[model samples]
Target: MLLPQVLPALVVGVAASLMFLGISFLSEEFQVVLWDDLPDALGIGRYSSLWMITMLTATGIAVGLVVWKAPGHSGPDPASEGLGGAPLAPGLVPSLLLASALGLAGGVSLGPENPIIAANIALAYWLGRKAQPSLPGAAWVALASAATIGALFGTPVAAALVLSEALSSQPGRGSLWDRIFAPLVAAGAGALTTQLLAEPSFDIGLPPLSDPGWGDLLAALVIAPAAAVFGLAACYLFPYVHTAFRRLRHPMLMLPLGGLVLGLLGALGGHLTLFKGLEETKELAASVGGWSSGELAKLAVVKLLALLVAASCGFRGGRIFPAVFIGAAFGLLAQALVPEVHPAVAVSSAVLGVLLATTRQGWISLFIGAALAASPSMLALLCVASLPAWLIVTGRPQLELDHEGKALH
Candidate 1:
């Protein structure tokens, strides 16, 4: 039993590793070309970084074109999908892979989770069928999803917690550990490979939390629900945004127009508010002390709206990366307004609220919030904050949009 678990994990892990490695390589090379080679070779950026805005605009248009014409509709509109899905036929894989590469490289403000998850599932199934034909199709989906998630987050435990909740809700045979054994094996291998390739760290390098005060706890209890309402505001607007864009009824027209509008937003918000926001999150954190409250507020507002536009306009990507960045910005703004509050408490609490409202994954929300400052005390506060935060959005529709441009249930 253990041998079977370990063996499939080894195979699936390698496939996932190679899949993400290729994507990272392509994304980097493409960025170099778009933001570096093309700019330098053309003597652009002489006056300002306005050239970046132009590049992002063009990227939006180009990606829209690919999504419109790509085979298999780029393997499904990301607005309607989650991070994982069933294995696709080999014939429908290429277009998704290409579109994802383009989006990742072109600075389309989306992550590679969806396409990579689907791609890994397809590859894992092909290999699994060759070597172990007895594995159920659902088992392949679980294995691939867990492996890819572990690789992406650089932690096997994330997969474990996520799968634990997911599997508990479904009817299944065997003990929970027995069902998750192979997935954990796959997660561990995948996380190890990803760390070796490139460590996936989301830390903002905040001061460690040693002592969290009562004020901090009270503020967290209050501020976190406020952030949830802030995030839920976008959720309410999501359907309207999607419906407005869908009225164009064609990706070519709708997406390019969205790109142009997004480019204008980038122009107003500057580079810090652009991209999927991993790098920019670090930039924001490092420069938090220097930024004025007004500037931080602008960043929080601009990025929030930009995320809405990008997702509503048919760009392919995941929401978690940008959502975390949004939470960080909101936290910074809170700290700016109230200098007496602890930075770690503010940031982690705001993240807890935003992520809970956005991802609706309680463990991951609290995990990410606490991990920001590496503070156990803050984790306790987020635990308190999350209950009320969960209540605020319990009956609200999710941020995802369906094919008809409506919010999901």
Candidate 2:
């Protein structure tokens, strides 16, 4: 009985770890190749409206080629794919990775990091099955899945926490080795890749934080429930949006529709809301001192709307990047209201919004929030704010999709 339980976990975890290692190398290689070769080879220049349009057009064409040629690769919006919480098809890994890379690199306003992580896990399971056809199955696949997730997000703790919560959410379940082993191996591999590639660290600049006063804490208390409301709404709306788009059923039409909607939103919100959040978020954090609380609030609303539309359409990626973007906007707004606290503290606090909207596990949310903040003071605030966020989210409706692409009843 013990052997049956443990063996699957070990095999899945190790396989996931190896796959994580390989994906990290590939991710770096893809980035370098695009930077060095794409610019010179394709003559794409400094990103501008014209350049972005060109890039978007190219991405659509590329997506068209792939979707037409490789049918198995096409799936639901990957940002919400995790909401499915089911094992992925092994053959889908390569195409998923390629599509994500193309989407991210070609300026289609998608992030590949999460998809890469998921793909690595799928690849791990495929390899393991080939090597050990007799390996017993358990929740080890979930563990391995967590390991790959940890590698991408730069925090194994968060990845592990998510896996544990996912398992516990199912009740009457126990720990799976796959969850622990793969993430450990993948995180190790990812760290090695990060060091060797000298990848730029994610730096969100916020001023030093002061201790949270009663008022700040109270505001956080209110914000937690508000954030949970948004998270639940997102979980509810995403599937409908996806279903509506699928009814159109044409990749060519679907992608351009995404581009048009995104571009229109960008025009309304300014181009800052258009692409991935990295550059714009850093810029926003730096300028938090200049904006009024109300203006910052508007940015948050717009970002939330934009991200919802982006995910609902046929976009091929994750919401975490845009969630950070939306959270940072809220932080800046809150800073405008609470000038007494550090801007970093405000950013850190607003991040609860992202966590609440995304997961039931408070620690996982806090970990991601603190990772984005990258400061000891911010981490402390994250722990405090996460409490109420967790409580509010504890009973929110879940977004569960089954293996057959149907919502679980």
User: How would you encode candidate 1's per-residue C-alpha lDDT over 118-210 as one tens digit per residue?
Assistant: 888887787788778888777878888889888888888888988897889999888999999999888888889999888778788887779
Task: For candidate 2, write residues 1-409 as lDDT tens digits.
Answer: 3445345444444444455456445645654555456666777654444544554555656665565467565554553465224557877766766666566554455555456556655655566567556643333355456555555555556566666666655655336654345445544454444434444456776655445567656666655556556656766665676677667777776666665665555545665665557667888887768877776777777667666665555556666677777778876776677676556656766676665665444666677667666766566656777777666666554443443435432
Q: How badly does each model clash, as a count of residue pairs? A: 0, 7
For residue 111, model 1's alpha carbon misses the true position, in angstroms, by 1.9
Residue pairs in clash, model 1:
none
- RMSD of candidate 1 to true structure, Å: 1.9
Give lDDT: candidate 2, residue 45.
Answer: 55
* Alpha-carbon local distance difference test for all models: 0.79, 0.59
Runs with alpha carbons beyond 4 Å of true place in candidate 1: 46-49
Relative to the true structure, candidate 1 reaches a TM of: 0.95
